[model samples]
Target: MLQQSSAALASVFDRASEDYDRTGAAFFTPLGRRLVEKARVEPGSSVLDVGCGSGACLFPAALATGPKGRVVGIDLAPGMVGRARRAAESQRLGNVSVQLMDAFRPEFHGARFDFVLSSMVLVWLPDSAEVLERYRPLLNPGGRFAFCNPRLTGQDGIPFVPEIFGTVMESVGVHPKTFFEDLDNGWLGAPDAALLKAGYTGIEVCDETYSLELLSGEDWVRWSWSHGFRSFWERVPQARLGELEKEVAEGIDLLRDSDGVIRIPGTVRYVSAST
Candidate 1:
């Protein structure tokens, strides 16, 4: 119910599996670490990283759980899970394993986790509430579940001028519905107070915002194309895509400081609950 081009987005990530994991430093950005930290992993704890991506969430879980413990990463995308498996094997991380599994209908026997962590994935799922319900059975007593998903901020975004994306989209004449709106309608949150209604305890909810320092016009352009403007661009004329890119880059340049760094603000909602 939330994502519009989820299938395409999944494919894009799947295609970038290797690049996604190998860029360890960039992969586990401060934002990712913040999400991982919420799990409160301990030595000997058994962890499950749902929608683990390549290894962004998996490796961190492994480190937190330690040799005495173990981490199992799973993703609905087979390619992502496969990439995670390879990385674990390459790093000789005997305590870690990855599996291809559905985020909403994870196939596991009994309550098995000390902690479960998910980032960004929940916001894109159509049945996020049901997803949480499915996960509830997997969390053992005293186990916790934590997740991070962006909160839409209704702010005026970059104005399009002439850029790669704009040019391409203009040529083809495509426009995708792009807007930052409150997370609701099951994908983000539910009126039922789903978490509490589902019987989670010690629920802690927090707001987290990430203000990025865009290093270059290219970085800003790429970031916007991959994020907020993504769905919009897909609907834009193919030729206008480039023009939009140029426009976004130009907007970013105007925001850049003398040091050539442009900062943009973003926000997400984080929550951690225990059973």
Candidate 2:
């Protein structure tokens, strides 16, 4: 079951890789940069970016670490790996390298990295605490582990834009709860206990809010299909996609400003811990 889920996730990301962050959406790149900054990556540091989609966190970390440092990025999707690698080469970022590897099962030696970072990726895993424990060995002594997840108030705390889509999903018989069960289970809202359980210390959590602007409802649809939200869209049947688009557009239209743009507010919670 795990293998099947991983394969499906890889396939979805593979399809999304080509236009993942290139769709003119100001989401992942800025968030990635913020995460790297918050992580305080120093010059000459060795970093490992788990689930590095299209060199988001990878590129920024490389720049922070300078040419003398090394930044290795790993992802399960071949397309993502290829895209990141190509981008790295084009930018002449010799300090960066991207590989196709599972996040839960990285194949690097123990204590290989000064920092292990993941941006907006940990909440999707089935067992974030266990994954944290597994990744601890990859970091050197006093190394840091930092990651981000969507902030939720509770089990029902779906963001406004996603709540709009969740309503549409319900129209097609898919429950919104299916996507947030893990988060609702407490790993996302309260991760300190999990970090401690995973043998990490010096934990810090920061809350950040960002505004996402889309020119129109269609832009929202495109943005949704570009990232992790694509997983939600995949559960929607093909025949119902048109209906989904129409309904989503109508729903989004309700939030448009006088300028015909939609602004959705979101919160990201950043957590960092030391080995």
Candidate 3:
């Protein structure tokens, strides 16, 4: 089951790599930087970014740790690691290195870190507590682990294309797994007690809402295609992908206001703790 899930995750992100950085830049990147910032990273500190997609947090973390410090980023997707490495090279970040590695079973030879950071990742795992416990030993004494994930409160964010697409597909007798199904099956909450059970102290979790403005339904569709909709698209028949995209776009179009801008709402909770 772990191997299958890992393959699915790698395939999803590998296929999304081309547009992941751009689509994620609007939100995921900022959230990752925030997680690193809250970790209180200082110069010469050793930092690890788990599930680091396209260097969103890796670059900022490298800068935060300065030239003397080391920042290592790992992702299950080789495509994402390639993209991140390119960005780091382009920026001449000699202190930062990205590798294709699994977050669930991260291994380093006699290596530990001052801070371990992840963002928008825990929600996809089947067991948040187990993952946290796995990471605990990698941290130095009193080292911190900080991460963030969507809160899923109220209306489960905007665009609403995934649910709509699932409905459309099911109506046609083609049942594809919906995005919410993944959320329902995976880590869903703040994991406060889980952190305690994982031997973490000084745990803090904060909830915040972020408002995003989309120019039109097309924009939202593009972003979704690059992020949340990747798995759905893969499950769909190749010949039916165009139809699905059109249907989802039409549904998203109705979400626009009189001024033509869509107000997409998102809520996330940040978790930080000392190991």
Candidate 4:
């Protein structure tokens, strides 16, 4: 069952394809950006954006590398790749390109990057440690590998409904996994200590917790239902789904004050190592 769920998650972003760029960017959590900064690419350096997700992390990367350097974003979903390409073109960024490809099967084909970066996408892979080991051979010496590791953050910041997740599962006689895979074990500690056990060097890891604000309850919940946790919603009871949405909104309201601003707690783990 875990295997099937993992496989589905690998492909699930397709359902959120259309709204991903707009919604994710709007809700673009700060942790991802901080991770990219730690990568510290220089002008003319080559960079790879794994799980690019409509290039949410690419634009800043392009600017970081300047015009001489090139940024390539690879995503498993064809829809995301297409949207990324459109996004690059809209910004007229000549140095960045988006491609549809799997990180597990990196057919870079004639390209080597100075930095290989992934943000919040590693949780789905059971063999992420091995995957990083595979990436080492492709990086230029002194190049860095980095990603934003989450500590069960963003639930409160969500602009849509997730307060109904447990009820949604109960209604169907099932257990509901949260919007994410619950990778919280290592935001401050090594979730995957095996990463260093593998032959990588110059390791530095740290986590920071922060608060993120979203418009209101409904928008946050709707966005989560549409993008962040679509699979959870699909398996939920169809009849009582609206109730779940309402419950989610009510929960969000309770978390707020007289000013009506909803604040969600977020924790980010940032890790970087030399390849």
**Top candidate when judged by lDDT against the true structure:** 2
Segments of candidate 3 deviating more than 4 angstroms: 1-4, 23-25, 154-166, 169-187
State the local distance difference test value for candidate 1.
0.66
TM-score of each: 0.81, 0.94, 0.88, 0.85
Q: List, residue by residue over 1-275, the lDDT tens digit for candidate 3.
A: 12137777887888888898485227777777787788888899999999998887888899899999999999998889999999999989899999899788888977999999998776665555688999998999999999887775535532233356567667555444444444544455547778888899999888887655677666666786675456655657788878877887677677778997776666778889998
lDDT of 4 at 111: 67
Model 2, residue pairs in steric clash = none
List model 1 lDDT by residue over 1-275, tens digit each: 13545466566556555555342223234655677787678888999888888777778788888898988888776678887888899999999998877677789877489889997677656557766678878888899889887665334232222234344444455532132233433445432277877788888887766666666666755554443344555565666657766766665577767876666655667788888
Candidate 2 vs candidate 4: the TM-score winner is 2
Q: State each candidate's clash count.
A: 43, 0, 0, 10
In order, candidate lDDTs are 0.66, 0.84, 0.76, 0.68
Model 4: per-residue Cα lDDT over 228-262, one tens digit each: 36666676678877887777777666777567677
TM-score of 3: 0.88
In candidate 4, how many Å is residue 51 off?
0.1
Residue 160 lDDT in model 3? 33
